[model samples]
Target chain A: MGTQAIRFVGYIFGAALLGLLALPVTSLVGAISVQKFLAGVYHPLFWPAISLSLRTTILSIGFVVLLGTPLAWWMAHQTSRIGRLTTVVVHLPIIMPPAVVGVALLQAFGRKGWFGTLLSAQGLNVSFTVAAVVIAQMTVAAPFYVQASIQAFKKISPDVWVVARSLGASPIEVFLRVGVPMAIPGLISGVLLAWARALGEFGATLVFAGNRVGHTQTLPLAIFYALESDIELALVFSLILVLVGLVVILVISQW
Target chain B: MVDTSLIVQVQVSLGDFMLDVDLSISMKGRLAVIGPNGSGKTTLLKTIVGSVYPDKGHILVGDRVLSDTKLRIEVPVEDRQVGYVPQDYTLFPHMNVINNVAFGLSTGGRRGSRACKKEIALRMLGRFGCQQIAYRPVQQLSGGERQQVALAQALVTEPRLLLLDEPLVALDMTSRRVVRLLLQNYLSQLDIPTVFTTHDVRDVVSLADSVIVLSRGKVVQMGTLEELQKQPCNDFLVEFLGQQ
Candidate 1:
């Protein structure tokens, strides 16, 4: 083919792909009027799903950061076979199908499962509860944060740590003052990515936490339920999620 | 004989390479270690500063024992009171020049408020003619300016021993001459023992009182520059000192 012809064909393909991605969101926004969107916001299902999603996602992100930071730092510094194995293990969740994860979580935490029986003895049941929602979100989102954190920590020069120590800064002092500040930009972007993943979590949560309004029904679950009775409410929830994902992308680009 | 203020006897296995050296140095003058790349010059400095632990042997600076593998006593890096300026002058990129210098005092809880620590850091920068760049980020500094700031940061802690890895290898011709002269004047006035690694012969001629030539992680020769010049021990030394 001629160069000009090839260029024309490339543009056509690019435009088609962009249109395919943008059409769904645009169609959803176009179908709902401002009045319908505002009315959907006041639906009884609206507040419950929004509140549950916000609460569970915030808690899950907190746990992910607290637990992932140290693991990433340790993994960044490790050079052994164990370190390599840990890296593969950390990435497994991201590759595994979400439905499979839900099933595995059930097997581990269900009443008949090993830890489930132990917890049941203590009068605690984790299966299909709000706690199950948080756990499912955490399971799927932790990998993204940990992987990003490892890259951030690894980018730092080893000489900086040695120099800080030589200047009389303790190990903890070095981590807080030097390590955290240097890695802040990467860490922020990582948090945003993990938070977005947790917000949109569907398959795993649906299987593990069941659909119960005002309890385990997050924004995604509410949208799934609303599709049967009211398509307007579902469109509103999707638009909200799309806006949030857009804001995350814009913020990450700043970093 | 001068009193020995620094004693380093170490044997460390670094992957496929092995570093073995034993020496007693007086605090009367500075010592320079010259070697080819991967000759373990930086490794020796790291061992003294307690960054890289020795598999065997002891390191003593003044009256303090920094490490002794036999006795199972290894002082942590922060407690060693050794100042180190690495090859690229790895100043903390997140902080400005003054904050970088003040890190040692502020983090050590050295009997000073934050303002007082900054004042001390500013004074140290002034000594190196770098007060103008105190508030500027370290990323904006020129090569010569970075060397002075690194020196100030290391000195602000008032460490008993100082180690520098490739102090002038990163500078251009003009900045090299300027930084070399500045280092000569400043290092001469300090009383504590200083050990620096270098590739330039001018650094040894102008700054070091004695020299140790290393090859394949072993000290091949140890004496004054003139003595090494009069009797070159190996081809590496002959080529290094430009005696060929």
Candidate 2:
């Protein structure tokens, strides 16, 4: 049997499966009881979660970028075993069970844990605060940024950076002007992907941030909150995630 | 007033491959570092340009003692003011020809004003007859144009010495002829010394004031191109010297 025919068949079957998956969502949106959705959209809890999600995810993504760029650059340039090991270690949260990430964050930051007691004594609490949510988001999302940035850096010829230095661009200038600009497409796409992952972080968010409505309750928490009683609110959160995710895809598509 | 002789001694280990070489050069004189790939030709360039630290060595250029393992004297690349044009004329793709050249005018030295930077770059471009492409992105340039932009960038800084690694590798035949003519003219007219690497004897015939041939990480011969051509000592020299 010619495999070309099988590949064509696979493409048709794959597209049909995709259409089937899309049908329910299309039908649901078409059959939306507008009153329920509109009312749910206006519901006081909904917008707050959206705002909180945006704030925390953006903050986490910001730090991820700030710390990740140099780390990725270092990993790309370094010729050491430690650098390789650190690269793998940084990716642990991605493969980790979500519940394990939550448990680990608590152990590391909880009062009896390593730095938690010190943080509490110093007049700041992270375990049940907005900061904790950002930390949780960062823990799981940072690897994406690091991986993408490293790949982006890899695409560039290291010799160009060497030329920049010889030509008088500082290390900082080289990173900002040459390195960053060249890697913009990969970095931007990765950041968006990280934001998407962070936006939906639930298990880690719940255990680490301790969902407090209007404080640390991100949209994912709100979805969980809504799922217990109000399916409409849950549907609204799900719809918002889908909308934002599509927007991310569109934005990244431009890059 | 100062010695321009560059005394370089360095060692680096890449797993089982180790590079240990001692080399030297002088100002107002051109030295060619010719060698096969992985024979440490590029490594010597990197070390001299301050991109890589030598496990052990001394690198002195002109009046400056840039690096010496014995004294642990190290001057960072930003302060070295050495102009380097790497292989492919690796011009910044995003920058126009003017900006690419202007990049050389900034080291740890007082950053020239934007107007000054542009002015300096333009002068160099004009000198090289590349003013017409001053506003074009280097990526859009022909190989020769890219080489011109890169060279113009390096020269605009008024560097102490030029460090070029295979400067002619990127050019097409026609463009290479034109660029080579311009480059040869510039080399003769300018007083500054330069060091460059190449696999082509044309580099020797056209621009090199003196030639330093390296075979397997060691200098096989050093002399004027005429002297080498007249007396081809080794098989490698005979084989290399006869090529087009």
The residue pairs in collision within model 1 are none
lDDT of 1 at B3: 88
Error of 1 at B94 (Å): 1.9
Q: Model 2 over residues B78-146: C-alpha lDDT tens digits?
A: 677788888878877777888788877655465659898788889889998899999987768888778
TM-score between candidate 1 and the true structure: 0.93
Model 1 lDDT, residue B168, Cα: 93
Error of 2 at A118 (Å): 0.5
Lowest summed lDDT across 10 adjacent residues in model 2 chain A is found at A24-33
Pairs that collide, model 2: B101-B153
Candidate 2 off by > 4 Å: A8-35, B1-4, B9-12, B109-111
lDDT tens string, model 1, B23-112? 777975589998889999999998898878899999999878999999998999999989999989989999999999999997766687
What does each candidate score in C-alpha RMSD? 2.4, 2.5
Model 2 chain B poorest 10 in a row by lDDT: B103-112
What is the DockQ score of candidate 1, to 2 decimals?
Answer: 0.82
